[model samples]
Target: MTINVPGRFEVGTTVVRRHVWGGKVWSAMPYRVLEDVGDYLTVASWPGLRGLVSTTWIKAFLDDGHGRDQTIQELASGTWRLGWWAWQGTTVRSWYGLDAYFTVRQYFDADRRPLSWYVDFDLPKQRTRMGIDTFDLLLDLVAEPDLSRIQWKDVEEYEHGRRLGLIDDRAHQGVLAAREEVVGLIESRQGPFAHDWSPLPLEGWRTPVLPVDVRSGAVSSGLWIS
Candidate 1:
């Protein structure tokens, strides 16, 4: 059987906040753009949910030239293998829950300007072990106007933990507040700002592209940024 695989993404750019969950009260995940192709893309996160994700699962947002913001709807999902540091310099390598659920959506601004972007995740149906992380970004359009700063807060929320009410309501509130704060800060400065939350790291991770050997269906060598 021939499986459909997404094409490779381009290098040196990242897309933020492509996936959103919930109906009216939505929770979203913003990812750091690793690579982008015409139809697909790749993202990376530091201290990721399951530690790391593979290149196949990351997908790009579809953009429509309309005013309404885009939304993501899951279509298919994929997984990744990750390695993490345990106690005393020990490393553990296993299948981490790094996947995406196929999605559809558009990107927009506060004024409802169309940015033409949509994002999706490739996740599995069965509950997989994972962690929850919060990422924050501060944009100063006044001084050094072109630069944006980011801060990441990693919180480990297991499936059991969530079920046990271990994921406090305050934690979720904090993320939403942070997002609003950034948006307000930008609006005050007459600058446009975008905010996103994800189980994935939105910044500080990089995946380099290497030459592929079609004969072997293997990549020669690639670089990864931590």
Candidate 2:
């Protein structure tokens, strides 16, 4: 797969996800800039919501996943991982983030048909930026695809990390708000899980080119981010 090396993404243009905060970018996922939303820029990752949330729907429903079809969806600084005092491999291959009571995830088979949809319970995504860069707290939610299944992967370690002062708090409130909003989405099923959710990505369009930095251990890593 070939990664798009387009000139720096133009405002409102779609670009692959890089470590907006650090590490490496996921080449498979595509996101379009949606204007800087004061604290952070809002970019819509593709299949862009139309099939997921728009009236012009399809097999698409907005249950979140690694739209770029990457093996790892994220990475954090070494310090963040060290603070956790635990390891979930070194990178993210396929993962999503959630907090509060639960998080919703939509899965599909190779053919793009709905595989299973489920929720996970865990700590809310802690969003904080370092030097104008935003990143999530390094914690994870472990759950199965069974609709009613859920559990947190790391509670003590996360609390321990916080005690060690690894998590930044300036955006703690804001990140909680964000996490609440995610919960709202799962609760209401308003956007991607709407009754009309359809038009799922199929065949060649189901994924994007995997980025080199994360391609090495693609199947082994998964992340839960905010």
Candidate 3:
């Protein structure tokens, strides 16, 4: 695949995610650029990085008995109760490609040791003025750091979303292909597994700032003022 490198975001530059769906911002996350070279862009987030999330989306995940019904309501209403999401887990380093169908993230424990690898299937990323635009396909794959074990996550959610028409046929097809790609990467020890997993020296870096108009639901341009 001839992937074109987009305009570079300098190392340590703050960028935001526009998790877009139906031309609306479903969610957003702020990350600091770690590396931007060739076809891959590496970004990192820590415990203090603020993010935007949808409360309605959260409800759909929590209400077991009515989860499917709630999801249907969410899709039809297209309503989002946006709120702040303080980053709480350990540090995360996500590797993305503008043309790739998925993102690979390495999770670190509280002491910064490697935890595991997470593969999130998503739409091909598009570079935006704020940062990047992509939507998750509701499916994910998780593997141990040594790649000795692997399992699929969110299979039930993915299938439910597909049945509810949240994931269209085209996107469904992309997710299928991405699943195979992720497996190949694991078996070959390619992609992120090919690089050193040493923790980056982030002693002096501050948490990235969230965009000011986080509640406005405006996606694409004008997210960051700086």
Candidate 4:
């Protein structure tokens, strides 16, 4: 579905509690909507992580629960400008595990649906390649394995070993269980996978703590709000 906004979406505030794979849970961090430019919306977070998230990333806008939106943009360079945001504060203290600048962009199909979203991770002086890295894990979750072995341990291991250490101590188990459940649904052909993950929120979006594992060796739980 497309976002039908009269103008830009009124930026709202929410707290995003991020849990890295093997790390601690950063809680009660605030994020405020800074700009909503039709197809895309930029939001600012405390401990400061600016998110140029697609309106499509929004599962729910206000605490009262509203609809969602999408993002679409292109620059002259082959480098299509998708969205931009800035994150503040030391990465060590806040939830997001890694300390760096984060930026996100999207490529769309003729119908305006996102073909793929790319993320860039900028560290202090040190720069890392930009792109999606979790594509493999997402494939594994959707393709072959049935839901029988869906355990948090595997995800935990993967997150800890592969990405920075961040995991919600309180909701870890539940999140793992929920992951398994979503996998089961996918294996049964009841849901969408990475290839077909459209409809805004992933089938597992509402499954608390299931955030995008950023390519920066850091996993963004996307569980925070301002």
lDDT of 1 by residue, 4-79 (tens): 2333223333322211111110122323444333333344433222212112223221223231111111111112
TM-score of 3: 0.86
lDDT for each residue of candidate 3 in 72-136, tens digit (9 for 90 to 100)? 45644677666667777699999997678799999998899999999988778777656777777
TM-score of each: 0.21, 0.39, 0.86, 0.24
Winner by TM-score between candidate 4 and candidate 3: 3
lDDT of 4: 0.28
Among all candidates shown, the one with the greatest lDDT: 3
After superposition of all CA atoms, the RMSD between model 1 and the true structure is 17.9
| Candidate 2: worst-modelled 10 consecutive residues by lDDT | 51-60
Error of 2 at 188 (Å): 2.2
Please identify which of the two predictions, 1 or 3, would achieve the higher lDDT against the true structure.
3
lDDT score of residue 151 within candidate 2:
50
Candidate 1 vs 2: which has more TM-score: 2
Residues 1-226, model 2: lDDT tens digits: 2222322223444333322223322223343343332322333333322111111111111333222111112122222211101111111112233133233445544344544553333233223211111133434443333324445444554455445443445334543564566445545655333423243323243323323333222222123243
Model 2 score (lDDT): 0.32
